[model samples]
Target: MSLLFLAAVNVSPEAMAQGANDEVVREAQPSQSVQNVLREEHALFSDRLTIEPGISYSYSDRSNLALSGFLALDAIFLGNINVDTVESHTTTFDLSTRYGITNRLEVELMIPYVYRSSQYETIGAGASTGGLVEESVSQGDLGDISAGIYYRLLPEAEVRPDVVWNFSVRAPTGKHPYDIRTNSRIVDDGEGGFENLTVPTSLPTGNGVWGVSSGLSFLKTVDPAIIFANIGYTHNIKRSFDDIGSSEEDVPGEVNLGDSIRLGFGTAFALNERFSLSMSFTHQHAFETKVTTDGGPEQTVIGSSANAASVNFGATYGLSDTTSIVTSVGIGLTDDAPDLTLDFRIPFQI
Candidate 1:
């Protein structure tokens, strides 16, 4: 965390007791104030180095029910009902290094390791007894690595806020969702037929495509409070894979992932010199994804576009002049977002 000091004026007691003819000399003193601790966590210090290690965890669960068959006489309906439920948990550990190339520019690189687990359950699907089937998968691997550059477009002033522009590129170095084999079992249907139920054998650790993002952030300080906002867009490069199909046969195809737009704003209050609290809201909207199979015409994937929104609360504590601890909790506000997320980071300046 960063610290700011306010200048104070002190007058001699003797001078204050003297008459109007006596001139009192005042001395300026410095006192601690909380100002930029939240917005400027990674502020660029000329020719300085900073290393941050962080861990984050997220959990989400979704359930869906589908019915097939027609209604009889608009009264009692006859249908084949199926219920699908999935629960997922993810954890990531990452290390980030930032170097200041100049007073106005800095660069950063981050590498992460991810572990994921998911459970899938189906009820009343191809079963005469309405039995429940469940499967679980877990995987751990390296996540996508990214590098970014930050430029201070406008320095903070008494009448204006600090403005920064950043650009980043992400590499697809982790396990992707595509081309993973699935485990299947044959189940008997109530109508004397059999159906194959399948589930993934492993979870994906990355999106599999390269991505580029650009964003601008604004920060302003007002006495004991700091305000910040940011907006960004991400573009995912189109990539091809040897097998994008779900069937047993190999079907090569190209996948064009949906681009996304992100927006966030927050405010922080300094409780004291070493501690601060923050609250923020963030939202991301993703476009629809498209795919081309076997060089065929591109087809859009329905329901692939989604909006995710979350509210977050954060705290930062300065342990020393060169080190700080930052922690945050996020609660999902939309169906597309995770149910809850927690993050912890410790940054050391050298």
Candidate 2:
């Protein structure tokens, strides 16, 4: 959601106005013209030798209602409805460096430390058990480490948008969710007896799978406004695990998570030379997940496909020539998305 858009803001307005003087110097000497041109050129995207360090904070809230389980015998049926809600807060510190091997090629490395905390609440009602609220808190790591490269295919022109091809590889560096055990106890049954009940534990910070992504990005500048769009696809590499159980029963297998397609477009308008505002929409569609058990056939997980969308509003303010603050709020546009998200980032260019 964040990019080094302010990398070129180190140039002062006074220096920009010196273009007239630089042009005069260029006309007087050919060798100085090369230096003058380099000084005048401002890169809107990644420039050579730019290293950016940033920290970001994000918060999101979500809720869902589902039928957890049911009991039936003969012609009688009993059902339970579980209302689940969660709120998560995450903080990530990342250092990203972009180096241009050529004017049209850039390589980037990004490393991140992520901390996350989430609160979970569940309320259930049924025949044997009365409605009760169970709550728990969990916190840990979040995203994996990743590296990327951007290759510019076409440069921006008066009528043509700049095009870039993006490729990235992700490593499983965070704590992966696996070998989880459920907490269980005897609870009051509505009929005065007791029933064994179980509740879910906290989630892990990573998926434990390597991933790769490729995409195409486009950008255009129109005076006071900039337009950007991208489409990407990500594939998660299948890996074997000791245990892959949703509950107590062990289901060891090689899991293949569903691949996803991401589409996004946005526009940023410069309110002034030091500030900008943006609005964007993002959508993702995940294919059905398939899991293959040891010596068993691959099975498609039911209800594993997901569609999520969000609308985001963002603003960026310059704190200095090398530092900036960026903030964004996202509203969910679909049931699969978080109800709301808030993010704040501070980035420094070195």
Number of the predicted model whose TM-score against the real structure is largest = 1
RMSD of each: 6.2, 6.6
Lowest summed lDDT window (length 10), candidate 1: 1-10
Q: lDDT for every model?
A: 0.77, 0.64
Best by lDDT: 1
Q: Model 1 over residues 122-186: C-alpha lDDT tens digits?
A: 88756432777788889999999999988888877777777778899999999998788888856
Collision pairs in model 1: none
Encode model 2's per-residue lDDT on 9-102: one tens digit a residue: 1223343333655663221211111111111111234353655566666566776767645657755446666666676777777776766677
* Prediction 2 TM-score vs. true: 0.78
Model 2: which residue pairs collide?
none
